[model samples]
Target chain A: MTIASITGIGWVTPMSMGCGRDYKTLTAEAGKLPKLTSRMIFGERLPRFGRLDGYSKLGFAATGFALKDAHLDQWVEKRPIGVIASTVYGCLATDIDYYETVVPEGGAFASPNLFAYTLPNVFLGEVAIHFGLTGAAFVINEPELSGIAGLRMALNNLILEECSIMLAGFCDAGRPESFQYPVEVTPGAVFFVLEKTPGDETLSYGDLDMDIEGTIFFKGAQVQNLQNLMQRCIAVQSI
Target chain B: MEIRRAEIKKVCIVDTAVVTALGNTLQDTWKRLIKGDSGIGPIKRFPVGTYDSRIAATVDDLRPIQDRSIIYDLIGRLLAGLKDIPQDTALITATTKLGIDNLENIRRKKAARAGDVLPSSMPEMVSGKLGLKKAGINVSASCASSTIAIAQGSAMIASGQADAVLVCCADIVTEFTFSGFSSLKIVSPVPCRPFDKERSGLTLGDGAAALFLMSDERAIQEGRKCMATIKGWGIANDAFHITSPAQDGSGLASAIEMALVRGGLQHEHISAISAHGTGTMYNDLMELTAFNKVFCGRKLPVYSVKGATGHTVGASGGIEVALATETLAAQTVPPTAGFQNPEEGAEGMISSKPVYLKGDYLLTTNSGFGGINAAILLERGTNL
Candidate 1:
């Protein structure tokens, strides 16, 4: 089977902003876990582990860079074939705001602005709506593995006669309360424009030698190994 | 690699974990289900003002695990004996609403910025919790998320990609979900009735279910007890509407047909069907139409366990598959609760009582938003 390669990689993490820089640069700048930005506003009630902003801003930032990385900015006017955006946590902010008003305050209506973010796939929807790429648009919620799964799903869709170019990735603007924890919480988005044509671009990312393997019962050790493998793969590619 | 027979070698309900209003474990859930117990109750987790529909099948007292963590702890007490852990396993989680339960609360307060909710990222939290070495997460299509996860995991094994795949599907009941469905007017004040004439709407529930998939050859080689084999699966899109299903049921019927073809069986070969009867008027009607289209009036005992366990969003598909597996293993299908009479429109479509049968094949089907539909065939161990 002809495997799909990452022709372009665009990312927005806490360490840095865009895919213009490689993973190494981002990892190198990985400093101590930042304080929950919400804490500054909400005090003790804020979460300990979350990203800096939210997913939309981060998603757009990443998309812009990834389009440039893939040299598809020129095709932005024409719009691509498909879009698959996966997020473990959808637009939670919108849901929270909408619920607080309607449920507690006895508000008769929900804010249409807030409601716009209600759909978890709205970020991708916005990208499609903006780009006018209407081939196939899907939103998947696979938790942390959403990124890899999004890539694989895009690959499969391309193979199964779904679309030609697939914009696949995962994005999340961390949880509010969880941001206070000791862990590294960052709002990030990563996207790749997968195409069948293997275009001629000097900086083109290689195809992923991917294999979806493992048993249903995974322990801590197995998860760590998978993380290590991913880290190593990114590191090797960087080198 | 010429794709020959797409045989799903071995599928293990390796680890089943659930958090519902009934209980947390499979045993507890089964006990509650057998006694016709209701997980729905007054809304306590969040303040429900004057909402007429205050009932829900909620998982009470679920704390936040660290970001990117394993979900085994949700059913930690039940898994005391299984010790042989695979070191290099991949993790795949399915969920509809991830980590938005509490974040929604904070967002309401406007206490935190929007960016702070990233840690609640469901897949990252689950992967981090499990600490999976190689992982692939899939939200897939709507209610069929987890089932599709299982199917994808099985495909991974069949393709010799991974030795094992841990597929977990989880969702939590939140005010956001309640409100969204309520806006759609699909929430029933009372319990849900699948295929019943008086069926009003579906009551939403939250829970997580996990399973393991490995090759039969590998399992036998390792002397592992082979629970069952995933015979085949089929996935398709309706291309009709975003929320409502196509009335013609062409997409669903096509999926069923493809599943049978993939499993190398005829419609008569299936002993029972675990249906996606969401208790909604349109969903039940469409599913019945699809069933009749496929079976052509063959009375294959059909069961919808949503009555016992409210519609569990993404986890519904996986949980139903687990229930179907148990039913097949026990050779006794549980009766669909609240199924008094078939709907006027679906008269000859649904089965009223649980019929005892001696067959090796079970078919499970799930449909989700975005016109996504999936079907899987599970044959008895003897067939393997």
Candidate 2:
């Protein structure tokens, strides 16, 4: 089956921001923490220890870059695109703040504005809503692999299930201290635009190979036997 | 493209590890399980006020290695003996609440930490720990998460995506999962009694299990011992309620039927079944109905280990499969610990005694909250 190629890539991570032109530059200078882009929208002194920049702003910036990378901004109205956005932590900072405001204060809250961001997939949903995408919009929760799995599933749909285009990736913007064990926090997102097409034969992310049947050997004398077999295969391949 | 029942050749459980209520190390947990002991105890980690469910299978002080970095240490332990894990081998992680236990702790201390509970971010931490530049983490479909992880890993290998793949599924008990199940009023106050008529509900437990998969040709070349072959598997969605399974077991039965069809077996070929018996009213009943539908009223030995190892959630499928492999290898089926009386409707189908049976085939099934149902067939040796 001819699977889709990741023609467009957009990313925002603690180490880098934007995609394509800016992304290459940012990633080249990696290992630095991303700025608190959400603080500007919500204002400084946001109570949360780990808060990303405003989700909408970050998402819009990433999308603009992705569309440019895919060269699909103009075709957005005509193309049936499947949008899948995933995250381990959604807009948790916004949720916690809204909850506190409503429960402790008991008044009309401006927090409803943040409710849409709480659903981890809202970034993708927002993009879909903005583009009027009538195709499938899926939100998966697979912690870190969400992006890769999303991309794979999208490829499956494009090739096997017959979808035209898929916008898939992972995104998260939260502080490190917000976790049980605090590590330096970085805000990051990566998006890919995939479409079903013949293999480029020249350029690709990497070849995808899958095996549905395999052995799972545990503790036993057979372990040595299995080890020998592995060694022999590699040896023969090398020859 | 034709779907061939892919042949499993070089299977290597490149890594195997566990974190159970008994102890941190796989050796400790295995010792406890082999001795026929229980890890259920009072909830000490968190205060479980007058809620009926107080006892649980809690992990001992993992506090020492609570940092996300511990996952790497655990992986290192699991892969200690393996020699042929290629640098390019895909890493697939399955967990219900990835990194959320830490997030929950932060949330309790400061509500602002809630934003850290997303799933997309967990793989990076794990991959970083494993020194894996290429990996994937899946947290979809609840209890079947790890099972799906295994399935996906196998698929990756079959598709030639990688020479070998590492599949790890882990989850730690947290206030969020405990309280969430508590809110559903489905947690038993005592140890779980899967398939029992008087069974109240499941006892939530936490643990992690990892499995390594490789092609049969590779295994033969490496001389790695092949333990068991994944014959076939079926995955389907109920599209039903988020929590409650479809009462008729339509989705569950379809998955089982597909699994059997894929395994090239009739209902009678199954030697035994490792059920998902969560000990909850709805889940147990739904499973019973589904089993009956698959077996067509035939009597087959069935057992659930939840009584011994509480409901491990996403890890349950892999853990149970591991136990089932042992059972098949040893040709000894352990008695369902808490099977006192079968439910009124499932009396004819439930098995209570630990009957000694020898058969090459075993069927393992798991169900999750989002109406996700998965079934996999395994055979003792490849010839089956």
Candidate 3:
């Protein structure tokens, strides 16, 4: 069995923005997300933070909080800390934003800034650059942004010793405006910093157990979803 | 503490299939590749009057099925040639933009499947068609999507997560992508000349590929002929820029070094390299810089299929993997089509003629828009 310690958790949602342990219950109404500034998250200027698309902005803010919660934000050198993020409607809004530029002016007025952020993985690169992380980084597109898939894959990488640490989560900045069906998608992000289970569990939230087949378990039960797992970790820590 | 070490399993490529501008099957692609034919041509699928670079290696004959997304048609043609894949095999689909045309239709208020807009939809459709138990995850790491997918599948098998995996990827040339690249100003005005002195930029292409991988014991039990060995793989981000690679090529160098260490092979053991030579000035120079850094200026043979097939975006890596198996079997690296004059740094490494492989292992590398670089090492297959 491969075991990992959940050292930190962070999320940025319409309801709240803070560490997972400090997160409040889901009672706040969903609406427009607050303007996330680098000063609010990092207390310093993040290079290229202003040019990021909304999707990358949401993901970058959440990852920054997670690193801060883990106290790994002050690193002076590069580390092999990988990142694996999952999403459902990845960069669709940005895709639309970029596409709209192509229609009016016969593509002569296409925006390279918007074009750069079209792929979901661009934010991964952004976060890597911000944190000086040099490990295996990629994005997963799941049917639903529950983040279990990415979490499992992160555990596998840890088991295989592919990286020293991993930041695993999901971020969905839902289509700002849908073209059809008026579909509503919740815009939020949740990230957890994971590392090999340490001998000292003093700062760990909980232990994540996984078999070689990639089935993950926590507290002797199979992990159902990201929300449930976060709740369980918070509950155990509060005790 | 009863800590159990993860047992490493031997992963092998049993079967492969591809549909590119050059041909519809691996055999056809290999035949044309060795003969040094270019499949890239002027674009005709959509209106290109407004675009600066109007040519691409498009599969011109493939019409959308049922007036749906062209990606479905591309996938159908690529999968129709594959056979006998295990029902339990996990599926991982890769694409920079899956069914992106559907988004165009939805925007223009035309009929289209809304589900197809999501990258996950590809695996959902493929799993339902093939009755796969698991609706696999989709890797959307820009152009490195399929390469990372292959790496993930190999990791799954190496860690005993799945007995078999089928990695299928597809991408089509569309106005959206054409316009995006045009905006980036990296589209070559002519057919791309990878690693060439006069290389302008990349020529976009339409392509798809399906590679089935299995454990050595499972392949032996199923009596499947192994085509190549999945020796090692690594993925890394440049952390330098989103769209541009580091000038020093340290990111790709790290990935290649990681792959070498994982595979337990030295740089000299690699017979040749299948480079992600997209023909862009910065990209070609970056690849040469990385090769020089990793191989210590040994003058290793390097080649690119994009010169013939154009840059297939996410599908390029998968297509190249299919080509790598053939390269390993035939012990030859195909000519870098469109390559007439080699770049200064790539003088002895790239050529317009095919080169015979001198070793069993081949290194295939790809760098994408998000500064994502991936490298996979493949060993010539041997009987179990």
Candidate 4:
């Protein structure tokens, strides 16, 4: 009997940001990808997010907002928070850049940094290192249903009492169109802070479905638009 | 009012099968393992060029099938006898890189064309092929992927979420796979020597293993044989380094302690141990330290099959567990094939020859790249 309550929501897509301090909601034309630079990721930064890849930068920044929204500043470095992240196309861009470095001279040079992100598990490692999360971490790649899978893994761990609070989210980034590769994936990340209810003092949003006998439990997690939150953040009521 | 489980359920391992470099059936694989045979040799499909490693353990019998048909074929063999999966069974697929070999093909085409890249959601595909209707998901966490997936499967049954669960694990050894480890300098030029003083590093292997799990009641009702029982499981992170493990082995020890607590068993009850034993310096040292801490001066017999299977990556855990279940049933432990001289703090623990099972319980563990570690406790089944 596992009951996962949504305590905090932190979503960052091309359209808007939810559960952040300066929440930004765009108009109806906000579904396109945002041009993200290092400056836009960490403001007033001389060299904040330089070492991080674009794929990891989006995930890392979105997770930061989720963690901060959960008020886990004191607990971030101390407690072991389990993280289950979902991705459709993971590390595609980074793999391209890494392989390009390897093929030119037939093993003449190998960049260890580029080699790090070649595998998808490295993305989970980067996020775990950034947040000091030592709990069980799984980076699942399920075509269209990765977000739902991530939620189930997180809920299973939390219900088993491994961790009271867990961070489950979806992080997807587009690959270079010129490159010939796999399936299609849009660029975005949506993170939710799931807390085991009745133990912690945080207010709950609602209960998440855990009985998996029939329908998909995480089916209610998606939203077509950030219309409600957009109205509060932006001056435009047409959202 | 709160939601609570009525009672803790016993997770039972009903059946298991494997396809490795040696044989296709589980019995055949176990027989060859007991005789201490290694299938590692030079790969003929490609060239090594100037790489650090020259050979790998590969399953040569598997012909190239369709895109996802390899998994489908292996899983079909796993579900051979079972008539009813009850439409509520959980299907889990574990792999490090499902179809990473395709990346090279895309590159050869000038990187300007589209591709039939590996589907990230392979579990759904597997479930569809098997005609399973309830739930499906994929788990990818480096080498520990299948162990974690197996543990999750057992927990789903133990927690009353599902009546049955099937875990399928497979990974192919490719040039792209070889180059990465070669770049890291972790691939041994010769066959791997796990826990030996002269051990250099690991050799990669390609294989697939599947474990069908259900509750004890379901196993009894269906008149199925209970090969083993999943008593406990644990998962933890070192948080020390991205690739390297902690020197003190605290992270792994914590997980061992948790599994013991969960299974309601002590270290003294453990008869045999199936170790990760990746043949690397740090991995071997860290595992020895953790074993010493958990066993507390008890030199339990330890063995690793990597000498024969050659670290199948994500598939390694499932293969190891299948072998462990065989050991539990046979009441004998196979020799650590590549072990000759043992490392310090691991003296007398490495069984260089066939040894009898000491007790009724066995512990299997795996550690992976992201500082991730996982373990599952299996109890010998008497009802089989």
Query: Given candidate 3, what's the lDDT at residue B175?
Result: 86
B153-178, model 1: which lDDT tens digit per residue? 66666656566777777766666667
lDDT of 4: 0.73
Total clashes in model 1, counting residue pairs 3 or more apart in sequence or in different chains: 60
lDDT of 2 by residue, A1-239 (tens): 23454455555555555444333222223353445443432233434313323553455446545655566655434345665555544455554454344333222232433433433434443454344443334445554332545555555444333246677665556443423424333455556666555234232222222122222111111112211322222232233
Worst 10 residues of 4 chain B by lDDT: B110-119
How well is each residue in B1-384 modelled by candidate 4, as lDDT tens digits? Answer: 122445667889888878777677788888888888887888764467767788988776554354433334444554563345556678887887665555655666522113324435467656766788744767878889899889888877776777789988888776666777777788899888899988999989887888899988888888888899999888877777667888888767877777888798999999989999989988899999998999997989888988888889998889999889999999999888788899877888887788977678999999988788888899998684
Could you tell me the lDDT of residue A162 within candidate 4? 72
Clashing pairs in 4: A143-B121, A180-B113
lDDT tens readout by residue for model 3, B1-384: 122344588889999999999999989988998999989998887778887788999988987676479889888888888898778898999998988888888878878887777888889988887888889889998988999999888888887888899999998899899999988999999999999999999999999999999999899999988899988988888888889999899888888988887787999999999999999999989999999999999998999999888899999989999899999999999999999998998888898999888789999999987778999999998887
Q: Output the better candidate (1/3) by TM-score.
A: 3
Q: Order the candidates by TM-score, highest first — what do you get?
A: 3, 4, 1, 2
TM-score for model 2? 0.66
Interface RMSD measured for model 4: 3.0
Candidate 4 wrongly placed segments (more than 4 Å): A21-49, A75-77, A105-111, A175-183, A197-203, A207-209, A212-239, B1-6, B66-87, B110-116, B119-121
Q: Pick the candidate with the highest TM-score.
A: 3
Residue A233, model 4: Cα distance from true site in angstroms? 14
Local distance difference test, each candidate: 0.61, 0.58, 0.86, 0.73
lDDT assessment of candidate 1 = 0.61
How is the predicted docking of candidate 1 categorized under the CAPRI scheme? Answer: incorrect
